[model samples]
Target chain A: MKPIIKIQNLSKRYRLGGNGGARYATLRESLSGMMRAPLAILGRKGRASRPELWALKDINLEIMPGEVIGIIGSNGAGKSTLLKVISRVTEPTEGRVELYGRIGSLLEVGTGFHPELTGRENVYLNGAILGMKKEEIERKFNDIVRFAEVERFLDTPIKRYSSGMYVRLAFAVAAHLEPDVLLVDEVLSVGDMAFQKKCLQKISQMRSHSNAILIVSHNMIAVRAICEKVILLSQGQLAAAGRADEIVPLYEKLMLENVKTETVADEREEGMGIIRVKSVRLVNRAGTEARAFDTGESMKVVVEYEARQRAVSVVAYAAIRRPDGFICMGTSTRLEGVVLPPLEGPGVVELEISELLVIPGYYIMDVTFYDENFEFRTYFLGRKQISFQINSSLPSLDDKYGVFYQKHKWNIDDVNVNSPAHR
Target chain B: MGLTSNENVSALEPAVTKQTATITEASPIRHTSYQVPDNPLVVIAPTKSWVALNLGDLLTYRELLYFLIWRDVKVRYKQTALGAAWAIIQPLFTMLIFTLFFGRLAGISSEGIPYPIFAYAGLLPWTFFSNAISNGSSSLIGDSRLITKVYFPRMVIPIAAVGAGLVDFVIAFIILVGLMAYYGIGLSLNILMLPVLVLLLTLLATGVAMWMSALNLKYRDVRYALPFLIQLWMFASPIIYPASLVPERWKWALALNPLTGIIEGFRASLLGYRNFDWKTLTISAVITLIILIYSAYTFRRMEKGFADIV
Candidate 1:
């Protein structure tokens, strides 16, 4: 049997050195670039002067029909560009794709829906965009409406819908597309948990009809659950590809490696410096690979460094960032009016941010080495940002069935209006 | 639709290997094999003039454009007080204003036709042009989500914007014809030119709309300036007065507006105006042709960037 989709020597190169495309290009520059296009096509290697960056390079792939493939990568890994080229959203710099049949894509939730349009109108519009005919859309209209659970609000303008409802209705149209090929990008991050689960089930069911599914995501669990095969991209090249479980750990390791190498500190670790911050790692009580923490549980962050000289009045601080990039909180020993004596030799310092009462989402630890005056001996040093997720075994009283576990207290009591005893 | 995997590709096309590994090597793997394959498909569209559209493909997608147009129409009137009635109301009220200002107040001649009927004829095409231009200017930005996320004919956007306005044009046209009957003006043989004028207006509006829409994607300030430009453009056309009011030499320049011929031709057909000024109408036709070609070319040039920048 032939593969349903075939790609050969696919590559997408984007130039960042040139202005960010915000400014118009000068005629001379444009002409020069056009003139040099032939030389660049000849594949001349750069000699440490003129350079180029390949957003994707030498990507070759084939997918047999009915296969579900997951694309995983860190930021700037050419995952989106690859999908764009396949979906023909953007042309690849150099490549070819042989598509077997009609293509349907949901690169994002609510991709083609107009906000001013009613849910019913946007359904038809978005369905047509996915290559469905009017009669076909009408045939699935009720099923789509039911799946989205927006029958009551179908005639309401989409602008009035919540983001989740907008996503659901838009996704319902895509789910009913019934195309031979489906492309979904990392837009699963948009919808609520139950809807995402519903979407996943639909995708799995859609896959059984010989529909090829290509999913791009940063979420590991979703890929592991749905995709039989996985691909990993690293710095515009194919890094790894295999079964889901195998590729995910490799991608994680690659990300961790990138973090370690790119994490350079402004201040030195030692080298005649009064005090220096070195390495930072998040560890559980047992000191294993752990990012999740429970409320009231002791969590340790080891900030290791070498002391260059005998120092006094040294302080340490850690700032926590929520997954949304907001700084949840930060505190320091200096703020507490306490300073530690200096060490004469190299020493590893560990700061325990114990009893970490925070929400159950990804959080980053930012370590700072400072003097008693809050002047930075070293600012944001030593593995500056390390992420840790909070995992709770049991939810608090208020949100026992919620998506995330949060600590709270509540009480339930029958209200008695006559509690005053008829006074 | 993306199969961005190499191992699967390797399973399909095995790379060439020349060197043989030593027997001690595990699995006796080859020494070296490194080669990058060229893209197999090339764009070889015909360079011939007037590439015949694949009507089959267009027909297959007709339902899409139809749904798109319908969707636009529905969304336009979904929450209105009078709904589709507003479509007729807008042009009627505008015709009244044009009659008050350009007809009754200014004493402008309407080729001896009723002022309401004369203004209605001009307002019909003008509304289409103005509405198409304004909506078309920001159509790409308004549908950035669609452009960035999927692949379709980007032309569908401006085309849909134009098509949806036809709903309003037809509605207002019925009212115009009703007023014509009320004014005791019978239809003339020149009315056969209505379809031709409609085609020209569609092409002309589409052409300019494509240009403005594409440019608006890059420079969003175009979106802000579009309404003001449309209002200014309305005055520049012959909707307020006849083209005969302008001098002959400058009248040549006025024909360059493109809408001059369409509007004057519209009124000339229905009112049976004798001095239809075929020479200026022909010049306007030529100008519209040029604008159409130029706008399509500009739109194609901007098409590649729409998915990225939008």
Candidate 2:
């Protein structure tokens, strides 16, 4: 079968260190550079010379109809650049892309929304911006308002609407565009949790209509839930491409390997140069050391340390930091009102979690050993010494909405007796 | 990870292909195939030589163009207390100042018609031309978000900016009609050519705007320099003063500036103060067309870098 989209040897190069003083070379630079061009050329004859950075290189992929592909990579791995090139937002420096259908790109939410315009006006304006005709927008007007749930504030200027309302209306307009090929960036992270689920469902529904969807995101669970095929990029080249199950784990393992190396070499071990952490490992209930854990599973974190000084008060503290570099949770033995005994030459401490209800994503662990006196002075601070992954086995789990899942139950007590099914 | 769900797609793949194959055989137009000979296949290459305008693409996006213009016009008056009254208020006050300073104090000649109507007629087109150019010149830079994120004819941005100015021109033109009614200066068959003059002015303004907007994307100095350029251009045109004040031998030189011919043509056709100069209007139209084509070519050439530079 012929592919719906074909990309041939695409590449994009950018000038380095150019956007700071100006986006491009100033007139003065051109003049001076012109005068020194010949000398510079002669000086560079014996050396390899170029200041260009290739954001994408020799990438070739064919996408079929009714397929959803996830593009996963570390930061600056050209994932977004590949999307921009395919969306025609920017031109590739080399090669070509042949497309067979109408393309609708959602590089950002509320991309063309005007703050001064009413929400009703923005819906039409945004619809037009996405290549919807006037008649089409009019036909979808009621559906859009209903989906956004902003009927009461339709006439109000979008500037007055809350941020949540603004994103809801924006996504509603975009979702109804129904292009044959949908290119979505990391825009689903907006809105509330239930709304994010609605958007994911909307994207999947678009796929059932024989449309092709390409999504780029760092949220592994989002890609795992929606994508059939996955492409992994590393350093501006395709590292691997296959099914998501095959690629996501490889990508996760690759990321964990990089973090492990950094953890070993980095200067995160901070203290008075004594009683430093030797190793920290996470062991599941099955007694196997693992870097990843499933939600609702018990796990143990073991910290092994070497202490040169004896008879000194030391309390082990651990903190979990989200990807945005904020500490989400932290705990210490002293904080829990348990006094630790004096440290010896070598020791081990274990912090066990009954059930890891945390959401799916990568997280950094900061383990430190502080004095028992609750003073601000620290005996040792191990910063980013270990990292772990908490994945959800539940199919309904959404990682974009929040970092943790709180356990709760719902009760419905009152019901009118109409049929046995009501009970 | 939906590891097992992908098996369902692989299971459904062959049936889907067979379905598409039969549909393509039945109706080629309705089927999805880039291989169809008559269906144009768009190949987006990294680098290609600059081509002339893709008028078909621009035509298809005419609705978007309309919406953009509507958005500009709406946003211009959205938060303002006076709303669109500012459109009428602006030219009226400018005309009043010119009537006082240039007509009374400076004793400018209006030929046979009243000075107020003469000045009003010239200012009508002058205001439109200036506003269109100033707004159009910054249209691309001002809409950096849309330009960088979306794919459309870059010319549409400046064109819409010029189109939005037409709303204000129509509003101010009503005052020109009122002045003509009060003065009892009847219009003749020459008044029918008013649209042609408006078109010529639009082409001229669009030409300058295209050039300025493209330059603004690169240097950004164009943003600061544009207002001063428009001020200088306004004085050079014969809005407050008559073109007759220039010596006839140098009238050819005055005609070199397209606005001179356009403003003089408006005064003659709208107010009948002087005989229409077809030769001057013809020369202005030719110059306008030439500038339009040149600037359009330059704009298309520079558009590829707009997203990168902007």
Candidate 3:
């Protein structure tokens, strides 16, 4: 079988500095520089150094046609660099690659779109970037519009579309393009659940049609569900490969150990400021081994603080940061009906987050103890950013992919109920 | 640290974890991984290439080029206070300035035509070329978000900028014709030379825009210096004064600016005046083509670094 993709030893390097000053140069300066050009080339330190960081080095790889592979790695693992080289978005410093057929890449959403242009206009525009002709775009126009599900807004300028809408539309156009090979980055991480599922199904459909796909994703679940093989990149080189089941665990373990070994927030805020929240372990009413909080479970965020002040009528606030740098939930004792008592030295405060409406995902908590008048406060009262995770089986499993997971029960209706089973 | 459920992806059965199972079977996930080809795949290569004219492939991507041009045109005046009228307003206002300052105040000759008409004529191609060069050159940096992410011809940016100025040029040309009618000047048959001038302006703009666009990707200082450079270039050309007034001895030297000849030729073509100096026009045309070709070569050489350094 003819290998559809190949990468030999590839490298990329860059020179830093030299981005200032005016463009004035007299003929004398020019002549002198021209004269010194040969001498400058011979100077030892004048060397830019193949300064030699190979984004990819000796990375000779071959893949059979129609085989889906997951390129997985931690950040700076050269995954994107490899993708960049393979996609021909950036040329390799060394090595050559040959493709028997046309290739389309979805490395970013709205890659070549003019935001002022309408979706219909951008479809033809972006299609042309993928090397499709006008007739080819027109033939697939309806399919593209239908798949993106922005048919009603097709005439509207894409700038008005939400980032989610942009990705969906862009990905839909890429999917319908029908290139022999597709390179997709973590673009599916956008959009709601149903849309993501639609994309996954569409990708599978593409596979059935014999279009090879390479995906880079941190979502191991998605990788396991779709990828036939997994190659893990570590520090610009292949760390592990061959199987997803084997490689993913090692990757996860590696990440988990990194998480435990380093308190990232502590390191980030070390010199900034430091105050302390003595304790943060939350507890329920029963307190009978309540390891996790359920949706609607009455919970207490126990905060004990040691402030460096008299702390009169002290106020305390807690906030949750979602993994994607979004604020999930936050509230202060002042916002609630609590006027804190004056604090002379140390204090313990129990704030009830009435109904934990958050869904399953990693959440980090930041606490601050302040004076009642909201005077200047130290960072996190010293404890820094503590971490937590939320899980709600019903909403997390069904509703959507955002921070909140509100409790709303549903009644099921079976079309075949009268046909016997449920009846 | 306790979220070990993800461990199922690596270890099959926990019972065999201590035994360290040598996983033989590849992961059953059905993803198709494309090989990165023996030669770099032409996947995200900018649709535009400056290496060779690549006009065949360009013709193939004509719709993209068309839409990009159209997009730039729309975006230019999308929410402007005067909308499409700004096109006419920009060149018309500049012509007024040149007429007042250079013609009226400084006492410059118009080669026997009305000052406004001759100045406007000079401003037409000059504005088109300058605007094209100015905007086209900085276009790559202006849309760094787009350039860094997607793989489209980087040349399209400067090309679009130049293309967008054509709309303004057309609008300004309409005004020029109306002015010509008002001034009672007859159209010379030499107007046949107008198309060639326009093409020359485009090639020159695209070429210089290529250099600026590519350079601007790395050094944004070019953007700041561009307007000043254009101001100096305006004086260097014959936009306000007649090129003939630059002194017969210095005319050959002044013609080196390229736009001087193109602008003079444009003015002479539309107005019933002196037939354009074929020698100066020929010299300017060749120089414009050379600068264009050379800048394009330099731009091509510089373009590969755009994604990385840009």
Candidate 4:
């Protein structure tokens, strides 16, 4: 059988300091640069120049029909660019792609939906924008409306509908687009859980139709659940491509490899250099390194650091941060009026908590060493030195509610006999 | 290491060797030999030279084009209280302003025709052209979400914008017909060329719009500069005054503005009072063709970066 899609030698280059570049220079800068061109050439060694950065380089792949490939990468790794090129949203700077069948891309839902247009009108409009023929939309109109569960308000303008309702209707119309090849981005991240599950179920059903699917998402669990194969990208280059079970773990290992104690600190790893944080490790109550923890369990963090010189009135502190990078809480020995004496060499500080309060998800560790007086000179901070995962104790409690898990007691008291008499 | 299995490595190695591997070695593999020899390949490369559009692909996506046009038309007057009446009201009011300022105040000549009917006839194609240019130039940026997500002929976007303007042109054309009736004018055989004139006007508008829209991706100044450009363009065309106002020597120069002949042609066709200037029409047609071809080429060249920058 013929392959559904093939990519060959794809590459994209972007010029820095120009329009749409990282610096986002305006017309004024360009005009001034033009004026300085002659002088800049005379002083060529010191002149600032727009450099080229390749977003994607030399990508080659073949996807057969019925195959689902998940593209996983860090930010700026060109995962989105790869999908954009495949969908022909952006032309490849140097490569070619051949597609064997009708292709549809759902990069976003409600792309062209107008607030004043009725839901019924928007369904057809959004459907057509997603490459659905008018006849196909007409035939599937009832099913789309049913799936979105907006039948009661189908004729009403969508502006009055809640945001959740808007996304539901948008996803429903997009779901009805039956193309031979589907390219989906992180559109599933929207809507409620039940609606998200419905969309995922619909996507799995779409796989049985012998169509090819390429998905790009930051949600690793969703990718692992749906994709058979995974393509891992690192710095605009293909790092690995294989089965999801094999590649996801390898990718995670590669991502965490920088956490080893042997590496030197560099830029992007924050520190004041008066004292350097050697490592940050999570431990269970039993004092053993814990790869993962369960909610409501006691935990500890060890901050190992080395002082460059003998320093009096020093303190050690650590902050726990959610996966979204906001600090959840901060604790310090100095803040609690417990400061260490003069320190000359390597040392370790252990901060303990009675129970971990974060719900199921990943959390980062940031350790800092500073003077007792909180002076700016001796301040040292390690931002996101390490990360740990938390598992939910009960399957019923999910991460969708919020990040922190609160502890509380629940009870029911019966006042049965007095109720009717009092009334 | 487990995920990077030998089989996976071997599966990925074939592409590298296929170019150099001998036929005998490849034929022995049953799986490789069983499938049809080769799938059609599409190689993407940067534009090295001028390129023409693929009409067959455009034809296949005709339904999408129709849908886009309908969407533009529907969304234009969606929440307005006056709805599509705004279309007629626009040109009507503009003609009134011109009749007041240029006709009564400035004492501009309208050949033998009445000022309102003359201006309205001129305004018909002018309104269509300006609307087409404005909407078409902004279409790509307006639908940046779609452009960055879906694959379709990029030309369909600007084409649909122009197509949507035809609805307004038709709506406003009705009022122009009424004006002609009130002015006691009759349609001549030359009116048969009205469709041809409209087609030329659309081509000119679409061509310029394609160029402007494509450039707008890089320099957003096009968005701000376009309205002022159109205002100046209207003055250059024969809208408020007749083309005969210009001396015979410079009429050729004025014909260089494509809309001059198109608007003059609209008057001659609908009002039946003026003779068609064949030389001016020929010059306009040639210039329109050149602009259309050149803009399509430039548009195609710039389309590659649209998704990246947009």
Model 4, A344-418: lDDT tens per residue?
778877888778777766666767666664443233433325667677756766555666777754344753332
Q: Give the lDDT of residue B39 in candidate 1.
A: 35
Residue-by-residue lDDT tens digits, candidate 2, A39-119: 888897422353677899999999876667899999999998888787777888998898877788887888789989999
lDDT tens string, model 1, A127-206? 88888877888887887888788999998887877666777787888877766678888766655456677777666555
Cα RMSD over interface residues, candidate 2? 7.0
Clash pairs of candidate 2?
none
Output the TM-score of candidate 1.
Answer: 0.69
lDDT of 3 by residue, B130-149 (tens): 88888887788677766555
Which should have the higher TM-score, number 1 or number 2? 2
Ranking according to TM-score, highest score first: 2, 3, 4, 1
Docking class of 2: incorrect
For model 3, what TM-score does chain A reach? 0.63
What are the RMSDs of all candidates, in order?
16.1, 13.3, 12.2, 15.0
Q: Give me the runs in candidate 3 sitting further than 4 Å from their true place.
A: A15-40, A48-52, A264-423, B1-57
Query: TM per model?
Result: 0.69, 0.76, 0.74, 0.74
Regions more than 4 Å wrong, model 2: A17-21, A24-50, A261-362, A365-423, B1-40
Give the Cα error of residue A397 in candidate 3, in Å.
24
